[model samples]
Target: MTTESIDTAAEIEAIHAVVAAVQKAQRAEDADAFLALFHPDAIWTTGGGKFLNGRDEISEFTRAVLPGATKDGYATYEPFFVRFIRPDVAAVKVRQQYFNHADELQSQGSPLYGMTKEDGRWLLTFCQNTPVVDH
Candidate 1:
């Protein structure tokens, strides 16, 4: 692999890890853990269309809404695509699956995460969650 390819591989892996962390945090309903993945100036939009500007806003919304969210169901996030808009910036599309305690599929989400590598760490800079309606 060329130098560029090698760097790309490592970046992709790092981005995937961030997505996995999101899943883990959400599954456990740990707001602090989930908020830690975002940049201090990050912007986020929930699947329901609420816009959260900045990490502080996101943190407030998350803390108020996330704690009991998974009481009935847990979600998993899997990166389906990672596109490098720049060496330090990545646009990641993730497939989110929610399953109930009974192990039945509950809902699905298509979340796009814009991550920027700062200080050698990938942080969620911009994100939008769109719920998928299964007909």
Candidate 2:
């Protein structure tokens, strides 16, 4: 494998880990764990059309929103594409599908996350969830 391929693979893996953290936190309804995946100055936009910036706002948003998902029944997520804009910056587009405790489908949407590497570890910088529109 070439140097470029190795770097890409590593970046992708890092992105995957970040997404996994988000999913795990959501499923478990743990705000602290979910916030751990983001930078101190991270910004978030929700499917309900709201913008939250900084760690405190991020925490508030997570605590308030995640429980709703849990109450409504949410499960895991799958990142459809992780695009490396540069060696230290990447974008991941994912579908966070929710299922009831009984494993019945609930809701799903594409959540786009932008992240950057600081001190060799990826931290989410921005996130937005695009609601699924039915025609």
Candidate 3:
């Protein structure tokens, strides 16, 4: 493999690490810690297409979502598409599959997240979670 390929792989891995850390913070219901995974001016959107811009809005959204998620039971974030747009930008597409204690996929949600490396750290700049709705 070429050096560029290796670096791309490593960068994608780093983005995964950021997602993992955010998941950890979410499971713990730690808003402060969760916010640490995002940029201060991060833009977030929900399945309903509601945008929460800036730190305050994002913080509130995290506070509301995390607790409910923890209560309903947290699902593992399985990353599907981990691709690099450029050396400094990357995106991760993850599936949040709701599971029971035995790990069954009760329901599922897909979240597309865009991240950027700034000052030697990878942080989420944008994210949108779209849950699969059943009628």
Number of the top TM-score candidate: 1
> Tens digit of lDDT per residue, candidate 2, span 1-135?
123544787778888988888888888888888888889998988888889988899898778767766775667778889877777778889987768888897777888899989999999898888877767
The lDDT-based order of candidates, best leading, equals 1, 2, 3
Q: For model 3, how does the per-residue alpha-carbon lDDT over 20-124 read when each residue is reduced to its tens digit?
A: 887788778888998888888889898778899987898887787777666756667877797777667777899777777666678888898888889989988
**Candidate 2, RMSD to the unseen true structure:** 2.7
Flag clash pairs in model 2: none
Alpha carbon lDDT of each predicted model: 0.90, 0.83, 0.81
Better of 1 and 3 by TM-score: 1
The true-versus-predicted C-alpha distance at residue 94 of model 2, in Å, is: 0.5
RMSD of 1: 2.4
Per-model TM values vs. the true structure: 0.93, 0.89, 0.85
Could you tell me the lDDT of residue 90 within candidate 3?
74
Candidate 3 weakest ten by summed lDDT: 1-10
Model 2, residue 115: distance off in Å is 0.7
- By the TM-score metric, which is better: model 1 or model 2? 1
